[model samples]
Target: MKKRSMAVMAAFALAAAGCSGGSGGANPSSGGAKPADSAPAKTEAPAKQVTLSYALWDKNQVPAMEEIIKKFKEKQPNIDVKIELTPSGKEYWQKMETAAIGGTLPDVLWMNGPNIVKYASNGMLMAIGDQVKASGLDLKNYPESLVNLYTVGGKLYGIPKDFDTVGMWYNKKMFDEAGVKYPDGNWDWNAVVEAAKKLTNPGKGVWGIAADMNSQEAYYNTIIQAGGGVISDDKKKSGYDSPEAIAGLKFWTDLIHVHKVSPTLAQMTDTTPIKLFESGKVAMLWAGSWNAIEFAKNEFTKDKVDVAALPKQKQQGVVIHGLANVISAKTKNPKEAWTFVSFLGSKEAAEILAKTGTVIPAFNGTQTTWVKSTPQFNLQVYIDMLSYSKPYPVSKDTSKWNNLETEYFKKAWTGELKIEDAAKQVATKMNEFLAQEK
Candidate 1:
């Protein structure tokens, strides 16, 4: 498996031809800011005719996302923005490394949370704090934690485009057929466990739930709700071994062993839990809002698949991942690229994303339609997630522990290691990695 950012491998076809710009980065058609209110029309210089290449990973999102680019073009007509999608997670990084090694990266790429910290520290990203301030963006509404995620050593590098949380994806038909009541937003983990038992029918090839050992999908909520965190405050240690965290990890591990309502982690490794849910092999899946588009487009139809808020653990909460639009440090047209990058984080862009149901926008209050638009299930889960959401863990070396999750988590999931033991091992390894960092 290629150990790299997911967005790195999505580089696709070259973008449509954009406005012509002089080889030297100067724009002949560059122009100005429009008059505001009754003030004399400001004769701003013409906007630069710059073409910026944007790299991303999701190919399925291209069609619906064109509208946003079109909107950006309407305002910044002189700026030609191209979208490039990398093919796979591994290849994305390989190709990006080739570019960076050659000093020819695209003007923009969807920066990853972990990558942002790494690149910014290496001076591979341009400071975006000034640009964000000039764009009149309300970063505060986006979530303070997210702002911190994209920031490294006190400087911002990207804008939080959209932040998403996980929820319990349940099969309504399964519930109805089993004569089990549907789970509401207020459902607790115990309630979910009970529902899982009632829904599981191994003889009929249906399991109550699919519990994959995914940090983002499975254990983050449990860890947080248990009042423990995946990493220590200073990023120098793992908190997985904490009393609260051990309790959390045990909850999921117990489901596979004691409860017997979900698949074992090994079973999930062969095929993801989501695939089980999609194939009608499972009754419930803890999924993130990012799945809304894929779930909506699922062949099973929206009726068979509905979403509800994640069940409460020791407390109410979910792990939220924020997708950000960041400019490449290598861009020659910083001004023009900034214009497009800022546009990507705007309210209009958020609306575009929400309307497409591709993602929950980070802009203030732009996700209302997205949540309500899908009528098959109450969309309130997206909103409900906000109150208890926390940013993804950040570090100078995120990969140090990113993969260790499943590696150590499987020990408990497989019954070889108690949750306490697994947590201790994970913490030990994570602390070693942190100690090695400057």
Candidate 2:
């Protein structure tokens, strides 16, 4: 239950020894010309078998990943891939760091926005921009924001796999009990506020909504909707001190402090927003596209819940974030590694992932399959938001400032500090970090 921003952890992993500064690397050497006239017999040397470790953190997606690996072997009969699963969060990053230090990091692995800059900057990742160009892979096949997210210093380090956007999920059962109509496209911030007021039933211990301090699902979406940018377009300045940004932060704090519709920060300490929605303790949950698979499979939610695009204020907004497949710079089999990464980025591999309904595939046309995979809810809301989706805010070393969000935001969530005051403090510290990121 760490915050979603932590989904992309700090880039403090030490750089590996001898990593190339750029995508440059030695090509596989081919056999030399046959000896002049001494040939008695010619025999093709046996193909060298290679075993590559493919690391990923999501156990739920392992089956699909293995299916992709299985398809990869048909084309690469001499190469074998071993699945390496790691529980996400700190443990996974720590293990990755240890492997990098030992020069044993997985040949192919998952990458995210926060760590791309760190790894690419330190030369821990292989630059695949050349391979992508050589293969004629159209960057347009995926969202441009995603491509830009994984690129650092004009070098592309990863290829997008899947993306998620924020949405409002409501329990139809609760809406009916509260006599409030279900949310829809016509809804706006005022509509939500009005409905939430009618939906709260303290006697039943159920609140109208969950206004947790989750930036991705809550504040980030609202901030953008309120015409506030999280960071300057250049990534060199913090936007938290703007009046628009303060208004956005106050929106949620007001829900907890003035509106009395959302659970208190203390009340939510043991249970998360998603959990409250899942257990029917809350009417609505602000969540991401990633929740589709979980909601489809959960007995309580599968039958009673549905989703709608987030209500807007000044603008339509939601943060779009995705994961990419990348290769380790020190991988012994760069050719094979690229082959696997390439396959993961292809439409076929995307179809396999889409069938699981776990995420919205980055491949252009494969999203429809994911939408149809689940009929219980309107998954199209996620895809619809894509047109206006804003890339999650990031920088060369997002971790440097990402950690500071919880530190400063918690005070406001707990009502220990004024929302504007807390936001200004965060902006001051975030600006200090932005200035140092050369």
Candidate 3:
């Protein structure tokens, strides 16, 4: 799931005052004991009904997921899929970790770039490479980066479900009010800074931008554009200490600390940057494609905002990442689970997701449907960005360095440490974590 999805889910819960995902629930029909790992009997006896648990995090996509499930059910009537929702990213992963340790992981579950290496390396996940080959599934149907993402040590553990890219989501009204030209494909970092200065109105309690701690949507893109990587290609070294990486980190801090065109850490914490942008208090927000659902649903932004290609620095760039569906190595119902996971990765499933506008289905050629799903906005900007976008950076253990990023960067964001200092500290600690990863 995209980072923004969790924040959006929290907002949705607050509005509804509420909150499946897997921590393992017993199936009375299948008994609480493990079943033998044998392929379905060749004769297909009785077609006994079997229930498989499917875990995912985004509540906003549940409707589309259910539609896909309906399609799956139509094909396999004897197989029942139980949708388990874990609305919070933190809680979802915690539960998944516990379930993994207990060998009670759900039959099928959502997987992301950050955790793929950890789970797959530990032998907690079942590689679907053989299954894909046997099924004649085209690996070319998905983006090569995403296919490579789920591939660990020559084994494929998951299949791409959906993908996302970052863009500059801006309020046109604010741009017009400030007499600043709207952002476009040609705009660069300097252009944005100049425009932001004109758009900022301190007396009106408005900011030109919201530079928060969202790496996927913000710094990561800039860092790569600046010719720095988060990790070495071998995934054994840190790049945060490099000059290019430091430049990327400084770009954001300068906006808040030096330029004074963005909200401070405290101000942002009071009300999220998303709320500020939606409420017309911030002129622009660096957001991912996952935000389309939330922005379209929110009354304040539905008709007021639009997106453009992210401004370039040294080069035009953005980060692309996607979610995948994987089956547990310990699943009691491997055949049924693989069936569901296979369906999840099918073009039929992609079309269902596309029509709903829930995500950019990873299946090749389906993005056009998603692009047309929201005609009001230039949704094509996201697809257009693919030409120059880089895969989101990750290592065997992305969360280790990712966590340190928030920890050390907070000092710079809060004005307690220089951007260079924070970045150097992050680099030092991140290197330690990278070294520890086998």
Candidate 4:
């Protein structure tokens, strides 16, 4: 849900004290009584005071982060952490890239799946595998997919912070008004279609769903549910042109064009799908677990919304993505940065973040509080979906192909290009990019 960044091993070494012994007897020339042999008092050196810069995009999570920082301060009084909030993911990444070029990147920052490989391959991130091992931080404490997500070229560059998956969010009031059965795990694409048809009301200006062209929250999950994938497992080719992918694409496009049960691309562009759903203009929204806090706080939708597993297609599946905390390779306070990063990844930090309801903490066994944070909604759907979730697809230079996806998919969504043709074109271009990665 939140786009982010790696981990560092903190190594705290207490300054060892040295002892100097005096002669048992004083010098006879001084005429002083024999002085007993005594060692100088041992004193440990004070730890060096270090300051670390932590960058993140989500302002909503700042409170939780600050709370974590407060606890970290008590543990390491010498280390001072400052939070830099960028607010926008696009601007955040752009700034990170510029900072990387200038070697002024933050000591610690959030890293996402799409940018991890690019950053790690370019040596912009510190390889923390050895440090993590030396610190005795068990990688097994996190999901294997997430741990593997931050690992590049046999080296781990980050530690997972949190994970998210998609679910179908529906307005209970709308469902009740339409007298349609609420969706559940058993519902498939056909059931979704039938429900959408029954729920659409042109007079009241309410759409059955908001079929936004979001990769993670919308089409990606459907693509996987349809038994399709965006890229091959080997990362050597594209799967966009496959019939299954097309079917997945059609599921959204048809809702807009054939079924007339969703808003058009232009409408969604003007007002985001989340806003539409929040305003009660859309009956259902496919969104990520990250929306829980916002939805729970919204006045209009707070008590009227609930989530269910995304309707099944060929099989049950969802796209799983997460944020990791990583250290900049250029950081001046490498040890201090690692110390803070290590603390952030600890179960203590995870529990703190979980109770805040800001995110589903990646540390195993720490998500129950987060789920319970919003008791009215079935937040557990997100955690349950993890069992069958597919890791968000990515590769070296994912942004290049990602841009291409947006460019061509827009044409398909607007009906300027047919879904089949657009998908094939994307596949051809994506394959070219993949080949170049070799």
Score every model by TM-score: 0.84, 0.86, 0.88, 0.88
For 97-166, candidate 4 gives per-residue lDDT tens digits of: 7677556889999988887877777677999887786777776667667777888889999888988888
Clashing pairs in 3: 20-84, 20-85, 21-84, 21-85
Expressed as tens digits, the lDDT of each residue in 223-300 for candidate 3 is 977888777777788888899999888889999989999999999999989999989999999998888988888898
Q: lDDT for every model?
A: 0.70, 0.78, 0.79, 0.80
Candidate 2 C-alpha lDDT tens digits along 1-438: 345223323334432111011111111011222212212121122267888888877766788888988987887787889999986544666677777555577999877776677777766799998888776666667766677677888899998888888789999999998789999866888898889889898888989998888877888888989999888889899999999889889999988898999999988888978789899999988987878888888889999999999988999877778888899999998877877787788777888889888778877667889999898889988878777777678777677677778888899999999999999999999999899888
Tell me the deviation in Å of residue 216 in model 4: 0.7
- Full-model lDDT, candidate 3: 0.79
Better of 2 and 4 by lDDT: 4
lDDT of 2 at 175: 95
Q: Give the Å shift of residue 386 in candidate 4.
A: 1.7
For model 2, the run of ten residues with the poorest summed lDDT: 19-28
Each prediction's RMSD to truth = 8.9, 9.7, 9.7, 15.5
Measured by TM-score, how close is model 1 to the native structure? Answer: 0.84
Decide which is better by lDDT, 1 or 2: 2
lDDT, candidate 1, 1-438, per-residue tens: 243333333211111111100010111012222112112111222355777898877665686568899987887678787888876544665566567545577888776665666556655578988866655655654545566677778898887776677788899888999999988878887898899999999788788988777667767777887778877667788887789888778878888999999877777878778788888889999887777787788888466878888877678867767667777787898877777777786666777887888877766566676786566766677777766676566566676576576577777788988878878888888889889778
lDDT of 3 at 134: 73
